[model samples]
Target chain A: MELIDNVSVAKKANVYFDGKCISHSLTLADGTKKSVGVILPSTLTFNTGAPEIMELVAGECRITLKGESEAKAYKAGESFNVPGDSSFQIEVTDTLHYVCHFG
Target chain B: MELIDNVSVAKKANVYFDGKCISHSLTLADGTKKSVGVILPSTLTFNTGAPEIMELVAGECRITLKGESEAKAYKAGESFNVPGDSSFQIEVTDTLHYVCHFG
Candidate 1:
């Protein structure tokens, strides 16, 4: 096993969308890389605004957009497709952790 | 987006083998969950002993055992099957970061 500690890896740039931090980072490689992400626990709430970024919650969390389809539970270890330009609301019955990327 | 901060999540146990800290954390759920792990930058080395835990390094890292098959490169974002009981040595030509998990 090789351990690489204390080395500086490139950090993605962060863009702000209505006071929310939208960080984006591209891999330092050249190819069709696979998508992998981890959604750690946080307390960010989404309103009727930018909606491409969907929060992945765990443990019986429900997400329902006002006047949209039925409320759906964001199951643990499962993923939800983030609508690019739709305003949606996500409510978690408990704390959550989620990490994802667009490759 | 749900940001779940400041909440105490269950952390996994740490098992040390030969002065190495193998800290682990299981999700606060119960089921046949898919595996997800992040192998951040570390400086852990492998020798002619314990070799089940393979490190995933990026950027043309070459791994060679004492006397095994021809040395192969530990390509970035690509995974190498860690021989359960074979020992190996890794040499990275540059700094790196890698994260992977088994399901």
Candidate 2:
């Protein structure tokens, strides 16, 4: 994604991954926490405790939200929202760059 | 940074940082290794064993190559080359997103 001119780096930036995907967390000036990450080719499931907006910074992926019958495709510059306390599955055909905003 | 379509994620990505900066290593399809990272506001020095191309993906920083008397500033979309077996200093005034390609 293009750089935002006014964001402040987190004082204690940390990296998170489990070999399949990787990401770093940062806190903005207004105390909003976000993570920018890359997801490799895999079919993975994730559970969320908070609402999330996942923005596709690069590449593409197919996402199947909870209770959904079919998966949806999202490419670069697109985004998908997941409700709090919900789960979703992502089928990545290629390396995908994403920024997840959590609330 | 905008993700390249042909690049493949590394099978084994390990996070690296000393609380000042955070990055994850990825290996491309052609076996080239690259790192995507974020640097917080700080002045830090790094040594390289191989030639490196540091691409500024987001924010800005002032960099001083070894043996240089003055520092140069680079912003998003800009890049700088560092020679192998040399060291460079980076003065970051803001959160900086970067991708480092090693050869």
The TM-score values for the models, in the order shown, are 0.30, 0.52
Worst 10 residues of 1 chain A by lDDT: A1-10
Tell me the lDDT of candidate 2: 0.71
In angstroms, the error of model 2 at A34 is: 14
Q: What is the TM-score (0 to 1) of candidate 1?
A: 0.30
Residue B46 of model 2 has an lDDT of 87
Give me the candidate number with maximum lDDT: 2
The local lDDT score (0 to 100) that residue B5 gets in candidate 1 is 17
Query: What's the C-alpha lDDT at position A73 in model 2?
Result: 97
Residue B15, candidate 1: Cα error in Å is: 20
**Strongest candidate by TM-score:** 2
Q: What TM-score does chain B alone reach in each candidate, compared with the true chain B?
A: 0.43, 0.87
Report the lDDT tens digits of candidate 2 across residue range B12-93.
Answer: 2233343356565544557676766777678999888999999887778999999998999999889999999999999988
What are the root-mean-square deviations of the candidates from the true structure over C-alphas? 14.5, 12.3
